[model samples]
Target: MEGHIVLKNVQKSFGPKQVLRGLSVSVKKGRSLVVIGGSGTGKSVMLKCILGIIRPDAGEIRVGGESCIGLKGKDRDAFLARFGMLFQGAALFDSLTVWENVAFGLIQGRGMARHAARDIAVEKLSQVGLSSDVAALYPAELSGGMQKRVGLARAIAADPEIIFFDEPTTGLDPIMADVINNLIVDCVKRLGATTISITHDMASARKIADDIAMIHKGQIIWQGEANKVNVSGNAYVDQFIHGRADGPIQMDVLKA
Candidate 1:
């Protein structure tokens, strides 16, 4: 109950290939935890299991101290309502305006009136440093940074107790990425929401994480405070944080 989210011996497999092998981690209430891993290491799958988009083969996922595994119908919806997500690549609807995208959960999920939802959407957008006029524009018209801001607005619009950020700073210039990182830290602090973010960006991880955990081959290999990452005493952590190719971790690339 004290932790916002907890995963215990969770496992998931796709046919013969296992993605999450008894993975376990916990996010303390109102704290920020960042999961760092390389590509195809089941980072996304772990998040999907927590979101109920993918069912785990075994083990338990608890949100606010209640079991969420195998929840169905209204039970699942209620469980989902307590969380917000900012997906990788700002997965906004191209057909909708900025405000409409931000207000989607309020109007569709919560069944709020359209006008009222739009007003709240604008307010959330403002909190993310967007002007009111930008709300009338479609996602396609905005730059990458602006689109990310819109996605952040939508993620926080519901004011949920927990937020999940998947690759929050991916595909942006260094400056823009840092800006988004700052916004994420500020917004989560203001809302007092427990956050779990997955990223390979060390800079972003340093900016937003209180604790950092590294996943490799479907299991957490190391976990410690963000400040202690430089001296983590784990070769895998050193290889990852320094982006070195000559370390203990071997990539699965075919020999030329």
Candidate 2:
């Protein structure tokens, strides 16, 4: 119960490809931890396993001191209720209005009344710097930044104890990304939520994380405080943070 999340030697595999390999990490309460890695380093798969979307081959995942690896039915739902997730690409329901999208979790997951949920949705939207007028418009009508704001509002609508941000600053201009990062910090601080973010954007990571962990080849190669990242002395971390081409990390290039 002391730690918000605990992963002990977690492992996952799909067919012949092994993903997470003996991964162990702990997320403290009300802190932000960012996981940085290249595209196929199992960053998303690790998150999926923690979310119970994918079952791990071996290891223990504990949330609030309870093992969540094999939870089922209402137990699983209760565990999930503690989390808020902002998916990559701002996955919103195109069929619904912005307000409706924000209220979806409230209405569907918590069984809140539409009117009350809509009001809360609008408030959350405003918190993310989206005006109430945008609430009535569909996602298709909004800009990319607006859509991301709406997605953020929905993530915080339930006021969860933990938040998962999957590439929160992706696909936005630098200025807009900074704005979103600031909003994320504000919202998480206000709610006192522990957060785990997966991002390749170093700026976003530096702005949002208290601690940084770098993953390579399905394992965490380095972890330290955000301020200590520059001196981590790990080649992979250096290569990643500096955006260097020549480093220990080699990209898999296909031959023509």
> Which candidate tops lDDT?
1
Residues 27-144, model 1: lDDT tens digits? 8999999999999999999999999999999999998888998899999888888888998999999999999999999999989999999999999999999999999999999999
lDDT of each: 0.94, 0.92
Off by over 4 Å in 2: 254-256
Q: What is the TM-score of each predicted model, taking all chains together?
A: 0.98, 0.97
Cα-based lDDT at residue 70, candidate 1: 85
What C-alpha lDDT does candidate 1 achieve relative to the native structure?
A: 0.94
RMSD of 2: 1.2
Query: Model 2, residue 254: displacement in angstroms?
Result: 4.2
Q: For candidate 2, lDDT tens digit of each residue in 154-176?
A: 99999999999999999999999
lDDT of 1 at 109: 91
